[model samples]
Target: MNSVIDLLMNHRSIRKFKPEPLAPEQKKAILGAAQMASTSSNVQAYSIISVTDPLLKKELAEFAGNQAYVEQCGLFLVFCADLSRLRNVTENCGEIFHQNTESFLVASLDAALAAQNAAIAAESLGLGICYIGGIRNVPHKVSEALRLPELVYPVFGMCIGVPDQEPSLRPRLPMQAVVHENAYDTGAVLEGIQEYDETTRRYYRERTGGQTDLSWSRSMADKYRLPVRPHIKPFVESKGFKLD
Candidate 1:
């Protein structure tokens, strides 16, 4: 309805980008917006790494499953959920730092919120952005490369640059399926799944020029059929996080 809404609705991941770097003021504004994202109890338990070194970007590109966009993008940022800073502050004050699954979840959510804000701000600046969850594929390596300390982990990475391509907006599930009125409605969700499956099937066909045609449900099933990132729990624990 409004310009902001239109901008939000039109968001799509950018896989290709121009070689130009962002303006200094543009980077500042995006980061300022991210820092203002809502945090849990003002904990502000997140950190961001701006990877500008060409060698480092190349390494991270490999770490992110060899995604060339990670290296090609003008700027690549790693958003981290960091409890280490809070622990240092608390213990330095002679108080025992309390940490558990709740704290972990809060930190992760904080990182996500800040990242979304950064994305919006970048988009508003006419910069295209894409989230790279593949950083988690080799979390420990990424941490070591970035010199992350204990109680800090990379939540995800982001690539930002001038857009070199215009991609079609991907469709989302019907609102009725995702939004329940006063309670959870199973029937509505199932109906939504059925409808979305067909929509996605057609989407894949058209996008791939009929080379691929798979329902959303089938794709999800295939994905979940195998274990995904089984190393995550162990890696997080190794970083001194107590999942208990």
Candidate 2:
């Protein structure tokens, strides 16, 4: 296999990281790679904050579900879906900011794609990284911590550093399950998911010494079973994004 394809296929989320800081030159290269990612309409409606403040990292760790890796990693970047710049430009032109759901989704997607590019770049440099989706758990706290203004929102956070442990590659669903033809096929999708459960079950059992009895379906159901788990609608409203 080609080196790039091999690297991508061997992907695993790294949670434990070494304490050594990344070199300045290396940091620049990684960020440059991220900037190279395709942006919607070339608008590049995203901003990344390279966080190094110890106190702020601690607070963010807490806000992000006490994920220790967030504070432990050598570099922490909070990727934001920023519309504030455009908002200001429009205001200067005597126009009001139209904060709609579609705009929010677009900005969020832009931030995510950019972040993924950075993650891949970090991995290429032998650095380990993990994305903290818990950044969304307490959206207001995240915004306040980052000092984000209106029309800007924290989509997610990423940690980058050398690995402390070599984690096993997690199994993925089969290609047949995810690859759909011209028309969508739900039956193939369901069957693929079922096969994936068995694959994941074997993976979890082997990796954790048979400690975790998790299959994909059960684990997913457990997640959805929780109501009021980090209530977010009100937080999104506070961020000035009208969902409905």
Question: What TM-score do all the candidates reach, one by one?
Answer: 0.99, 0.94
For model 2, residues 1-244, the per-residue Cα lDDT tens digits are 8999988987889999888889998899889998998987887888999999989998999999999999999999999988888788878999887877877777888899999999999999999999998988887888987899977888889999999999888888888788888978889989999999999999899988999868898988988887754566666667777775
Q: Give the per-residue Cα lDDT of candidate 1 at 226.
A: 95
Which candidate has the top score in lDDT?
1
lDDT value for model 2: 0.87
Stretches of candidate 2 exceeding 4 Å from the true structure:
227-230
- Model 2 weakest lDDT span, ten residues long: 228-237
Per-model C-alpha lDDT, please? Answer: 0.95, 0.87
Model 2 clashing residue pairs (backbone): none
lDDT of 1 by residue, 14-92 (tens): 9999988888899899999999999999999999999999899999999999999999998999999999999999999
